[model samples]
Target chain A: MAVYTEVPDSALSAFLDAYDLGTLLSYKGIAEGVENTNFFLHTTAGNFILTLYEKRVNEADLPFFLNLMEHLARRGLACPQPVRNRQGEALGRLCGRPAVIVSFLDGVSVKVPGVDQCRALGQALAALHAAGRDFGMTRANSLSVSAWRPLFAQAEHQADSVSPGLAARTRADLDLLESAWPTGLPGGVIHADLFTDNVFFIGEDLSGLIDFYFACTDAFAYDLAICLNAWCFSPDGSFHRDRAAALIAGYEAVRPLEAAEVEALPILARGAALRFMLTRLVDWLNVPPGALVQPKDPREYDRRLTFHRQARDARDYGRA
Target chain B: MAVYTEVPDSALSAFLDAYDLGTLLSYKGIAEGVENTNFFLHTTAGNFILTLYEKRVNEADLPFFLNLMEHLARRGLACPQPVRNRQGEALGRLCGRPAVIVSFLDGVSVKVPGVDQCRALGQALAALHAAGRDFGMTRANSLSVSAWRPLFAQAEHQADSVSPGLAARTRADLDLLESAWPTGLPGGVIHADLFTDNVFFIGEDLSGLIDFYFACTDAFAYDLAICLNAWCFSPDGSFHRDRAAALIAGYEAVRPLEAAEVEALPILARGAALRFMLTRLVDWLNVPPGALVQPKDPREYDRRLTFHRQARDARDYGRA
Candidate 1:
């Protein structure tokens, strides 16, 4: 849960005056989005979400994120559509930050998703990749392979502080992955981070995909690899082969993976694990004292990296 | 924003199995309550709040808090009412802590309430006082005048660290207020903490009163005294005489204060300020490292004390 900035009473009143959303009933800062300050809004217009883009989000990228949601939403994806104000603009400024109101989408995000939920997530993700293939924007994945080293450098001195041999081992792994990282895999707009919390479901049915701040044009299989690492692994670091099988099959049902994509799975998964490790390491080490945010353990990715390092083939991931 | 405890997926799913509240769609830890971990839950049934009582809350008082909410809600307070499971029990255990689900209350808490809101808050608080007069359970005001000395002692060592000479002046103020604190002034069930955030408004109407954990048997006038400091003060520390007048008049419209209660207003207000100052001081000085909970500045209460210390009669509060 995160709400880094507070919208004061006068500010909120002024902010709502710009909108046509009936008389303001109530609004609250929701503990949902990590990268933005999100508020659950209830007005005569209906329930909606008011998001204040925080420092972690790039101001220039606001339109890209907004438009992508609009694009996917128009395609019938259940995502938060930016609510336009009287000026017919979806974006506005508040609390010295870029802010916007969006139609509230109702759905619960599952915690430990069941097998059917896993399958539904895979199908939904692959469909999202296909839907965004024609979007009229391009954002390079800033957290991809090319950016890992720089991210690692920021936290290099404190890496061993997290675990012994963590820094050196990560450096060597980075070198190996960088040298062997696949190029020319089929690329498209990928939901690079499809964790359970980002995908909402109404019971067994997928209701929506949210938090597209990490969306970018990347190897389609790389997105799948991120999911393989994110969704198909148990909390203890063991890969759930059956769940992996279900997820892969579900994705293949929507958009079949190329043979080259299959061949690149292990390396992509390893790279995915390391990418998260480096960023989480930097954030874990650099969290300002007394911050409300609790950084995820970089060690989890360490364990995933170990598992991916030993995998021999896609068969080990339940690839058919 | 605070959510000290996280509810795991397994634990949540298991917890919901006991209730018939539709399939879980989503659950998010809310940034509202400070004493407990509160999640805004959306299930097939509808919206509800799931609270995990933290260690800071005494477990034995769970029934009292829940029952008081029930009592007030039964008397038409728009507060959250505890939801019962199939076994007809509203309280259950989750994450090894006392947990319960309550129906969601709609309406927003204003950051800077207007005069109408001040009047609405005053009327609602007095109504709460009458409604909860017969609540079967009784909890002593833990932060009342008698408790201030011990709380001040806990925070005495580091009080100056908060502000220069804050310790000695607070000590002097506490001695005076505690001795002058009036007794036998029409005591009854009181919503001891009626801060703005605990009161909600929809337009000019008061929608709800919440956070009854601090509800206890105390002087009815003490509750009004807390509101005087809470509602009648501006962010810049100046008292709004008109708003205070409106609040007192609104309150007296529902339940007229006895002559003795009116005479005791200044001391009650002073004691109330010190009670909060001491608790907030102890919390501010003793916050655990990296605690998401930020303690309220005791100096704000110091400012309030400064105001109350000079007032010799209720007219200074714009008393009707």
Candidate 2:
């Protein structure tokens, strides 16, 4: 729905021309996303997704996103690898926008992922982090610890509308996070947006991961925090200790968290909640009418941030 | 940064000519939101926020939003009241978009809100819910329980690359929510997007609330669930039991939750989380590269949803 680009049919045809994906049978715009122009293309070769980079995407970062898929795919992560053109370029021009074609992965996103699924996601994430250790590319975490205040400052004038004492509370949290930021933890390319939709699965088995646009070089524990927030909670703002434990065990099995990282989970979760709350709050206030994109409710992240503010221990997640 | 429309000087002048806001000294765009084009306006009358409705906001709902603000303000809520023109019209054209002028409340949003502040917010929110009971306007909750699946289904295909088991899990959650949706709770106009940034405070005192774009007729308990998620969580996705208790107590102090409502908190929280996660997940796969709008990390809602799934007791929220 948020197709900001007008990728031409010719561009898609060109991609088909270059790639070894036999013949294109059909292409239809996937009408649900808020960012890129996505076309679900059915070809004699196989089903694939053609994504035209939309405005919010950085052209310069295309390689990292494209190559990360390739890198992960090579490591048997079951992700959709970018299809390279004849000139050996994964990036191409489609509908006048920067475009790439990826294999259409099969599987539904788990709406109510079980504890085992959460654990699998954790393990897969750890494996991805481990594999990213040598990806030879790096991007700064745009939504990292340092970006909170400035983002909040941008909305300070109307901050009262979001919550009473939000600005000050955020400032205090920022200070706390800054002073107590975990240092020297395991670091690598972190999938900053590992929500349920970004990961695919079949039944209890994990399938693949997608949407690495927010991938960045940050402390691996931050990724764990992201996962803890993503996978270990139910929809009603309650923490599932079992799921949390399963997820943590899964991650620790692959790449054990450092003592400092484990200790910082609560605070890190708080930071992550703030980061999302700020962004969502800003978005909520500025949703553009006529645009197909849906404005998210900022309160969701606000609740998560509130939860993290009181989170005292990892065991609080569940009976350890 | 996502200013959908630029309000020119002429548009402001025309608006001033129609409204009784005296003279407009200057107005400039505020670049903190992704939904509406907001301008900080200084007039002889007072400081105000000039908002041009952006996408995802329905034009038909303008009167409901404007009137609700006026109603709340009239009822002694310290929120921004929409200014009407001579024709008794609150809606107008600015920068080729639907626009309105709102009296900006004076106060700074505290970044580090204390327990007292949290309690105050809870009380204020309860007052807001109480105020909405007889506002003479009603609009269905756009993010109600029934809307979650269709929203997620819209973006389901695009999310395939994220995790292997995401799709099935999402389906499962949807099925569960559908089967377990609570029927017949107290219903009223709710500030569905009440995050910290939307609420303001003067020092430790409550100032006012703003941004009523997502206000709609929904179950009051659902709104509470939203606040519980927004106000009770830390940034890192852990539950803040104290704040949760403070907030719920504050809400109960004004308008107590029904026994059924208390019992349904878990599912309500799940529904709320699912509502947001679906929206964020949809946004995640859709963000365009060059748009001023930032893509929210869907993982944030994923964490909240995870929390809701495991929520067992209100005591876990510091509520007895």
Badly placed stretches (over 4 Å) of model 2 are A1-320, B110-113
Q: Assess each model's interface with DockQ, reporting 2 decimals per model.
A: 0.65, 0.01
Candidate with maximal DockQ: 1
Q: lDDT of each model, Cα atoms only?
A: 0.86, 0.76
lDDT tens digits by residue: candidate 1, B134-253: 888888888787788888888788889998898898889877876777888887789888899998778678888878888888899999999998988875568888889989988988
Task: Score residue B137 of candidate 1 by CA lDDT.
Answer: 82
The C-alpha local distance difference test score for the whole of candidate 2 amounts to 0.76
lDDT of 1 at B262: 89
Give the per-residue lDDT digits (tens) of candidate 2, residues A127-235.
Answer: 9998888898888888888787888878877776777777777788888988877778779889998987778765357878888888888989888888877777665
RMSD of 2: 29.1
> What TM-score would you give candidate 1 relative to the actual structure?
0.96
